[model samples]
Target: MSTISAQAALLPTFSEVQKAHRRSDVLILDRHGELIHELRVDKTGRRLEWTKLKDVSPALVKAVLQSEDRRFYEHGGVDWKAVGAALIDRFFGSKTRGASTISMQVAVMVQRGGRPLGHKTFRQKWDQMAAARELEKSWKKDEILEAYLNLVSFRSELQGIAAASRGLFGKEPSGLDLKESCTLAALIRSPNALPAVVGQRAALLAQSLSPGEPGEAYRRTAIDALSRPYRLRPYLALAPQVAKILTAGAGQGELSAQTINSTLDLRLQRFALQSLRQQLDLLQGRHVGNGAVLVVDNATGNILAYVGNSGDSQVDGIVAKRQAGSTLKPFLYGLALEKRLLTTASVLDDTPLHISTERGIYMPHDYDHRPRGPVTVRTALSASLNIPAVRTQLLVGTEPFADRLRRVGFDLRRSAEFYGFSLALGTADVSLKELVNAYRCIARGGIVSPLHLTPGHSGRTLRAMDPKVAYLVSDILSDPGSRSVTFGLDNPLTTRYWTAVKTGTSKDMRDNWCIGFSRRYTVGVWVGNLSGDPMWNVSGVSGAAPVWLEVMNYLHGNVRSAPPPRPRGVVAARVPAGHGEAERGELFLAGTEPPSVPAARPAGEAWHIARIAYPPDGTIIVIDPDIPEPNQRVFFETENEAPGLKWRLNGELLPPGEEGRRWAPRVGRYELALVDNGGKVQDAVSFEVRGQNQ
Candidate 1:
């Protein structure tokens, strides 16, 4: 009796055992508590969350008791009647029968370094019996039964009732019927036995549970239950990428908590996944394999939907860094607008431009390879013109633009000189999450904040850009009439409601992106190959825009997406026709509004400013070796041809004739100047011809 008291004092309490059990997987739940994904973090034996006594099905409890211990409720810890009967059977019968109560099994399971049931020595058996008696005295009957159900190993790598029932039957323990409960209870006795043997034991247990039922019917049901394949079906699994992210460094306490409530909406996540898959299917045979989509709430910056990849690869596309195409143009133009360097109606030359950089000469061209001559900032941005964007990058300075991108969320670790003028064209690599959040900053009126995946988790917000500038950029992006230069009026970018959208295709069509925002949500989509292979003829408008449009339309199905109200410091003004744009109302900064007087000049009288059109400054004209020197002509053309304009080569006057405007190729450095009849230089450019005359 003293030894029993000592053993009981040494045993751990029920709460201690419950707290020590750790599951191998963590359950990620939606905001509404619906399971989204089940991620297995622990690679050891599979153990699910602890199943409470009250949560366990009554049928399962009765079945387990009937199979393991018939007098479970009647015995203190060990049934002396069954033990004595087993002893008598060992002496007289051919086979041996053993009796180990639920309390006894719980004692062995919870004991530190305790031997397994069949392998225990005689001394260990005595100790186990003594511990069982002590455990029954200190813990409740229900506690012992619950611990037994959880700590018992039912099958291979399956430890606990939760794992067994879910792995074998694909349902919760509470949903287990009589036959299913019997089948699971039979696993406790011979976990590694053949399925047919386990099935026979389950049939016997079922027959005992239902006395009047036919024995053969029970046998058939139990056999069918055991014959089916066993697999642990994941619950929901709508957000595998999110689950992987959240459980990256979780501690034991977090993993044991079982359910992590996230800010993801189940409906939106499902729809976004479906939409991305459908778009990738449509782009079949174009070498397009993977894509991702992200949707955020503009008000709170909560990530509503995140699809990492389109089932093509295991890589998470949401965080994968890819070259950002024209998507970064908005922020560049926004900075220019904020600094008052450019306005919506300000004219930007869309013609060829050559700028010297550390790497080499950088030449920017429009998407269609046809320049629109002179266009307003509104038209330049809306049409996604590359030359205008690169020129704007020059005005904003590459360092300042790169700094602006970093302030938002882009992970641009390189120096400004590394990105150079191409930064405006999104030459820097960025992830979908970073890009979407940056756009969300614009949607939130220029205030940048961290996106939250868990509810109630938020970070500080910073004013990345002025609200006025953000509003102006949004207004320009929403105007389809201005975007008609590139995407045309009728396209996927045009939604029924008001949405400011931009599409970008990276160099060599390796990546395509379509990001936009409605009044309530910001949606971003990317389509390309995850292997870094270029897509075949796939553009942003045709590849990613359709998915963006579908998601935007669904989000606004019941809600109206009205245009954002104009903020202060922005005023609309009527501008006279100039720079190839008709007279129209344009938004401008308060002090930068155009003067009321028309700026247009009379035609054919130097109405347009003349700039060297052909052989842009710093051009290296290479003479083809196969062609004769006289046949190779480098034409000198001005932006606006006037009556009195003359061409001067190497400071020498050229005769006024069309043939004189075309100079024969020569291996020498030359400076070409565009001068008026008064010999006043209007525009000049330098070029070097290199090659041996053939």
Candidate 2:
């Protein structure tokens, strides 16, 4: 047997050797700095895990030595006895036995395209031996052993002792048992062997290691251990996000073993994921295939939990743009209230109404297609009534409403005219992230700020709405009595604590959303098909509100989201029995009060007259041809419910003593007038009804 000459052998520098041993792995940590996930492969798709000798198991080191080179500690790199025996066996036409030491294997591992026992020429073999000797001289025994164990491939898709220990044994290298160690050592020769064959080989190796004793039990145990299926932490779902955080944009770098401290709370993340998955599973028969959830800290705007999807669909529901249903109504009403266009006690007509725009004839209807007549602004908003919201939008104007949405962090890429009046009902597309932050804006008392993902992240804050208006809107949303008209007294939106939540469903129930905030956290959830297919009989409350409630309840725990303090410019007024119906309390801007409201008018007085209430001067109401004539009506009301009030349309007298009347309108401009029994015109307004069908 010939030995490699030390004088002719080239040695690698310590730094070069260290660089050769470097492997790529990314570790994702939770907010508390605990490991949540690990990326164990480099960009080149190589499984290189650089483990320190101290972190490696001595048992694995001993097993590798016993399996590959029994005298690894004594040899420079070439085992002359084994090499000579292999050469003589080759000459005699017998099977060749391995004489490659761990150091030689490590040299092969580091060399480009080098592999164990691969095809090679005589000169290449000599060079490999010389390089192994050089490596042994450069690195200590422990380092050499650690490098070999980490660099060598154990089985199919298993590289390094750490990968083998996890991919094969479902554990860290330090936790490998004697049976597992022997089994892994046996796998070094043939990693892709069948489980039964692997068990047999591992059993033989274990018995050979203890030749004199009865080793059947140890062999069976090692074989059994090797045959078990591999297990790993259930963190594969978070791998893509970790990759994005580490390798996207400014973090672009070569893939290597890396540890990233993420802002995720594993507990909360697991809960959110489980909640979404459970809902998806329950609704699977309904063709519900995707869902996402986001939880943010209202104080810091830190995302506490983020579940991108609960199904196999690759779509990211959080950032994907979908229609914002009635979810945008709160902001619309808030804008109206902030402008003092309407007070909480102000009544709006929820009866059938149609509008004409450049787009076509626009007709808005409630979810149930049932009219709620003369409801207060608070109840109208809380019940998510369509007509009331449309009326409020008419008062607030579409341009200003779209601007308000943009100011509050909604991305309204189009002009106000692009959406027209349908904008009031949320016809525009928006992302879950933008919508959640907008709700967080209201939660933060009218301030718009971006959500922070990592610690120490700063954000710019802008006042998007008045704090008093925000407070009033929040109060109205929290009132069970207000929402009871639609969602009922006990639904998923009703929390044990105070939570102002709004639910919305896009056209044909393609997207459902339920977003709200507690005293501390704001959670938003979206459940729908990524393909944009309509859901089967799914409403906003049933589809998304339950998940929102689950996550909100989980976040709040036992604490309640208390009511926000009243802002400075807000006042609570008690309307007298005679002026306001039911004498209920109302919230209004300090200086914006109803004018000239008398407690009671004098009886039998000529001045005690009524004026036309509905179609208040210059009102342009459109009649949709799509709506049947019987379902269409122009309502006329008297300002005061006087007993002798009379109504007339186009100078044609209607029934006497009629305080209010419904005119089944046709396509024409009509003059409406209200007069008392004294033949005095109390009020007169000219309105036009135009019809168009698309």
Candidate 3:
């Protein structure tokens, strides 16, 4: 009755211990089945790998049995005395105590990770304890140890000893010195707060160790630790940032875990973290701080990395909502294009605008608060234009726009107040998770996959946007530059890597953002802080971009690059600048609201590039065999001929072209064009005037 030896009552028979060891012991094989991050992550969060336990120093087991529960061998999952004490504590003490056996604790630690260590009712607790007892009756003690080791969280994402030892101490579980063993064991209680730093806690652990010998017990612990030290590496996934999805993946329903296949590339994840940390170290005032990043396998909707807004603290690494800033443009623009409200070729004034909403009058401008007029959709997107995007959002209709965004995996309702004009500029409260998936819709050519942690929804398909529209938006996104600005260029660059990119800035210079895609993947970066303080002038381009570029450059290394899929549904037109009534003629051109682009009138009704023969950005072309140049209209090529409902040859109209049919061009680059089968007399692509090989 006087159970001084608590662990003694709990010890299972040798056969039982052997069987428990087998059931609880799980060998964690990496993607390659190479033992990497091993764990017993359910019960107490002790990270121990099963494979090497028998070979490694067994003294720790002896010590654990001696220290925590001497009655471990004789009792079931719970000793009635311990349970009663825990019950008494709950009813009388300020803090409750855990009354679990090595097996039950292992179950909790390995399977449950970290959650409250109690049950809602006595019956529920007793039932679970009973199950643990039943399992222990049939299993072995070592099995329980294996389970505990695997489930325990050693500091960060490290689950088993294998991961913890490597991630934290930078050594294997088997390599622990006595001090380290004592340190690690003490950590089982509070990994976040080091015992050395937290005086009282360290004292308690050091006291428990009571190694006996002034230095001998410690030496014994160390020697035993190194008997069979671990060797495998660790797994550190950068985890993708699909906040809502991953939130669910983590399961609010219950702490009970189910296998969740992640898109994380462990190697790339570590590299990204290293890259961002490096960038932060080089910033101004030594102030570069908190940030979140996401990487997606665009085609597969698999989130490769979810680096949350990390700071000096725990790095929570997966969930943080900072103002997205211009990172929201791709959605706005994609919505516009999808709704048929605008085309990549549509023009808008990037100057400030004053509007009276039901709430109040809203005025908007650019990052530098500068005014730019008559910019094309392509330019607006590339430059991360503020005014133009808002106007386009308005044209697309805010509620509809927001609804479309919601459909594509963004939850705007959570931060409706943060929306409005600036919302188009990313004022909404969103974590990297939300934006990553939304942006992924564009990259995935309009498909979306909500993050899933459990076995359910594996490889399941979830549709959020139209593929055609997604493709078009993705095309514009790839250019990063949007071709709105004119520069001295020899020729329009093909995707060089089928990539689309955009940069963003938040109010008060608090955030910088860069989101883009390659044919194979999509990456998003956000740099800012938790306090919502300014980051000086860290615009997306300057602050977040460098990091994004670094990660992307690595992701694409050695991979075959493909061009962004071409978009359809746009045409060519001709009209003088300030000459026509639509598209900002002299009235608006001189200093007023430019006249809106007039609705399509009957064709032959001229609408020109307004300015002749310009190299429009995002121009794509397919070359053809030689064809005789337009009936000798300048010794025309015997090369190719332009054909399409509306394919442009440098703002010039192409002859009616066929579909699903390849077109041979006049040995030059052609603006992949479209025709609005919607109406309009004749919307056609203008034939190219500047004949260049690129």
Candidate 4:
């Protein structure tokens, strides 16, 4: 008796055993406690959450007792009558069978590194029996039975009643019927036994349970239950990407908790996924294969919907870094406004620009390839003019702008010198999550915070930009008239309610992004091929904008999206027509409004502002091998041409022509100057002609 007590002290308590069990999979639930996904974390064995004694089906408990040990309730730990019969048969009878009560089985299960019940020797049997009696003294009958059901293996890879019932019958343990229960109880004896053998044992158990019932009926039912293969039904995979992200590095402690609640709204997640998939279907012919959608509550910065992919690939597009096209324009313009370097009424030249860089002369062009000349900051930003954006980047400085983007959570992963002027055109790579959260910051009046996926998890917020500047940028994006220069009046961007939105298309049409925000929600969508294949003529408006529009519309179906109130330090001022623009009221920072707008140039004032048109500032002329040296001529053209503007090449005055002047090809560096009638150089451009002169 003292030895038995010592053995029981070595074993774990019932509560301790329950606490140590870890489910193989983690359940992800939505904000309202709806199961969204289940991700397997443990690879060794498939054990679900331990089933409690009360939750187990009464029919299953009865079947297990009848099949494994008939006097389970009456015996203290070992069935002495069955044990005596087994001992008598072992020595004198032709057949031998062993009697191990449920308590004894559970005792072996709770013992540290206990051997299998089938292969135990005489000494091991005596120890197991002694431990069983000790366990009965410390653990209640119900505790022993519950531990047995959970610790015993019912089949390959399935270690608990919860896993077995769900794997074999596609239902919870409480929902198990009599025949199903009998089938599972039979698996306890010979786990990997043939289905026919299990069925025969199950039939006998069922017959003993219902002695008045027809034996053949029970046999058929048990056979039907065991004949077919069983597997756990596929989990509710509504948020597989979220599950993957949340379950990363989930150790045994986290797995023991079994379920994690996320801040995702199931209804919104479903809608966003449907919207993305539907948009991908329409763009199928254009080679657009995958896309992602993310929705956030602007106030809390909680991620409401995160559709990582369009069901075609495993890549999580929400966090995948892709080249950010013109999507970063708003922030660039916002930074400029915040620094008081530019205002909404300030005019920016959107014409072709050539700026010298470390690599070479970088040229920026608009999406339409036709420069609109000088445009207001509002129109330039709303229209997404690349040249104006580059000019703005020059004003804000590349390093400062990149730092601002970093403050808003963009992982640029490189120095500003690496990106250069192209940073204004969004040459830097950024993730959709980062992009959406940045937009949410704008929606929240320039305060940037980390987006949360799980409830009660939030990070500190930082002031990324002035609220007044954010308000100004948002107002410009919401204005349909300002964007009409690029996008027409009626489009997916023009919502019935007010919304601030932008679209971006990366170089080669590889990525399309549409990010926007109403008053309460910010929605971002990305459409492209995850395999990095460029789509066929697919722009952001046609690819990602529609999905954004659908989700935004659904989100604001019953809610109002009125324009945000103008923040302090921002005021509306009247501006007269100037710089090829019409007279209108524009928003500007206080004390920065211009007293008078510059007047438009008079008609036919060609000689007033003379600048070279052809072979722009840092031109590189490559001599074609196929063309004759004399036939290859470079046009010496000047904008605002006048009668006295002569073309001077290499400090030598060229002969003036009736129509236009032309220079013959030469393998040398030449400086062409536009000299006025007074012999004063108005504009000069240095160009190099390279090739074999022949």
Tens-digit lDDT string for candidate 3 (1-694): 2222332344444344323332112332223323222223244333333435664345445445544565787786677788788878878864876576666665443333333264447665654565566557655766666655544554544455666565545666666654555545545556565333423333344456563335444444433433334343424223323223433423222333322344455676667778887788777563567776778776656556656655435354345666778777777877776666676666788777988988888988876677777877766876667889889877876667667767776766554444766678778766666776677667766777775332224465567766655665665554422333421112122223456677777777877777777777778887877666787756665688788878887887788656543333322223233311222211111111223443332322322211111223333433333645432232112111222233344554455434222344455544433322221111112235344444
lDDT of 1 by residue, 306-340 (tens): 89998936699999999999999999999999889
For model 2, which pairs clash?
24-256, 24-257, 25-256, 25-257, 25-258, 26-258, 27-258
lDDT (Cα, 0-100) at 402 in candidate 4 = 96
Candidates, ranked, TM-score: 4, 1, 2, 3
RMSD of each: 16.9, 16.3, 13.8, 17.7
lDDT of 2 by residue, 1-694 (tens): 3445542244554456556654445666778977555554444323545667787777766666788899888888888888898899989999988777777777766665335667777877887788887777767887777667776777765677776777666678888766777778888888777766766666676666766645455467556655666544433445345345554542223544356666677788889888988988888888788888998888888877877778555467788899999999999999988888888888899998889887778889999999978888878988899888998889999999999999999899999999988898889999999989999888888988888666777688888889878888887877655687788754788665667888898998899999888778888999998889989888888899889989988877866655566666666555544322345445666666555443232222221124456876567888787888888887676554555657878887876533338678777888876655544444567788887741
| Ten-residue region with minimum lDDT total, candidate 1 | 600-609
Error of 1 at 442 (Å): 1.8
Which residue pairs in candidate 4 have backbone atoms (N, alpha carbon, C) closer than 3 angstroms, thus clashing? Answer: none
Question: Which rank order by lDDT, best down to worst?
Answer: 4, 1, 2, 3
Best by lDDT: 4
Give Cα-based local distance difference scores for all models.
0.83, 0.75, 0.55, 0.84
